[model samples]
Target: MGFLLNNRVGHLLIAIMLFVAVVAVLLLIAKVADGLRGKARMPAVIAVFAGPALLMLAVGLIYPFIRTVWMSFMDARSQNFIGFDNYVTALTADASVIAFRNTFLWVILTPLLSTTIGLVYAVLIDQSRLEKAAKALLFLPMAISFVGAGIIWRFVYDYKGAGQDQIGVINALLNSVGLAPVRFLQDAPGNTIFLILVLVWIEAGFAMVILSAAIKAVPVDIIEAARLDGANSWELFRNITVPSIRPSLVVVLTTISIATLKIFDITRTMTGAQFDTQVLANQMYDQSFVFGNNGLGSAMAVFIFLLVVPLVVFNVRQMAKNREVRG
Candidate 1:
């Protein structure tokens, strides 16, 4: 099995066989279902189709979640029940405190700044002749992976000592003006802000695309009616445009908030979670894989899960409310 997995041709053959076997099993189930009558056939088919999916879900998501929660209460080696000690360490330890604070900053600032910038951009470019081209320029960053964006921005914020030739864009500009070069990623607290800026630059494009569609979907008839009633641009935007796109705004905020909560790549890529810039996900990775402290890692994972649940629930409820209003 190891040799087959190691060989590319053998691996491809195994994958092809697995795919063929799954198709064959489904076809066999269909053929068997055809032999049964209506009432029996429907349920038999449903069971056949849903059983594998439910089993996979249980093995993949449900089992790991339960295991992680259980491990959160165990000793580092999983040989003893520590019972809340790991949670205490995760929540109150100095490093954990800093991670939590940085995560809090990320959750608060990234969504608000990204959404606001995107919405303003969307409104400005709405129905303009250069709208498509302008939006394409902004949204291009969305195509870049988080790690790629971090690498790109690292060059932008790169630092060298005074009187040295600077390669970083920001430092180079500072040098041209005789301003001293600053260490953007080495400074504490402020370094976290610079890391968050990378995520914002990437997510703003996503926010713009969603909010732009929402703005354009606002009824033209409603806008004309408001204009006829002597509503100025600001009044129309504040009263009509915003309300019309409230659901999209909620979605963009919550989606970005969730993404921000799980942010790992930017921190790991640029600073390796150094210089007081670690967030929950980065902390979790460090504890689990780097430090080999499973209990504390699981505790951090559980904490992040707790924070994300409310945002996900609110997003779902808001979407349902929007659907009902549309219905």
Candidate 2:
């Protein structure tokens, strides 16, 4: 069995055989159940189908969540139960407090900036002759993972000090205008903003793609009617386009806001959450793995879950409302 597992040819053969066997079994079940009554057949099929999924969900998601919640109430070592002390400690610690502030800023700024820029970009491309191509170019950043985007922007924000020739594009542009090189990553409040911009860059494409679809879905007749009534470009956008895509805008904002909250990779890759650049997700990791404080980490994890569930619920509600509107 070990040799078969280690052999790539054997592994591939086993996997193929298993898939074929499963298909054969399912067909055999269907054939055998063909003569069965409706209620009996549906029960058989659901037991076969949903049983494994329910079991896996129970084991993977439900159990782990329960354990984490329990652990959050425990001590750092998980030996003794400390109730809300871990939560208090996480809330009161200076670094954790900073993390909360930075996270709040990210959750607020990233969505608004990304959504606004993307909406504008979508609107601009809507009028362009090469609409598809323009939107495609703008949407290219969504193809890159957060880590990959962070690496690209890390060099863009790179600082080589004054007079030594700026390698980073931003500093180079500043140099061309005869300005001093600023430490883009080392500063406190400003660095946080710079880091948020990276997320915005990666997220803008996603927002643009969704919003562009919504914009195009606006009724051509309504737009024409408004135009005939002497409504200008700004009026058409503010009245027709904006109102038509309002639901999509809500989805985009809430979705990006949630992404911003759970953001970890970019911040970790760029600054390692150093210099007051830490957000909740990275701080959770830092507490759990780096500092070996499971209690605090679990608290942060629970807090993140609490924060995210509402945004997800809101997005779902908005999507449902959009569907109702369409209906």
Which lDDT values do the candidates have, in the order given?
A: 0.93, 0.91
On residues 47-76, what C-alpha lDDT tens digit does candidate 1 reach at each position?
678967987899899999999999999988
Model 1: lDDT equals: 0.93
Tell me the tens digit of each residue's lDDT in model 2 across 1-327: 777667988779898998798668767777766767877888667756775688779989999999999999998888899999989988999999999999999999999999999999999988689998988887888999999999999999989977798998899999999899999999999999999999898889999999999998998999999999999999999999998898999999999998898999999999999989999999999999998999999999999999999999999999899999989
Worst 10 residues of 1 by lDDT: 2-11
Each candidate structure's TM-score, on Cα atoms with residue i matched to residue i, is 0.92, 0.88
TM-score of candidate 1 relative to the true fold: 0.92
Candidate 2 clashing pairs? none
Candidate 1: segments with Cα more than 4 A from true spot = 1-28
Residue 86 lDDT (model 2): 89
RMSD of 2: 3.7
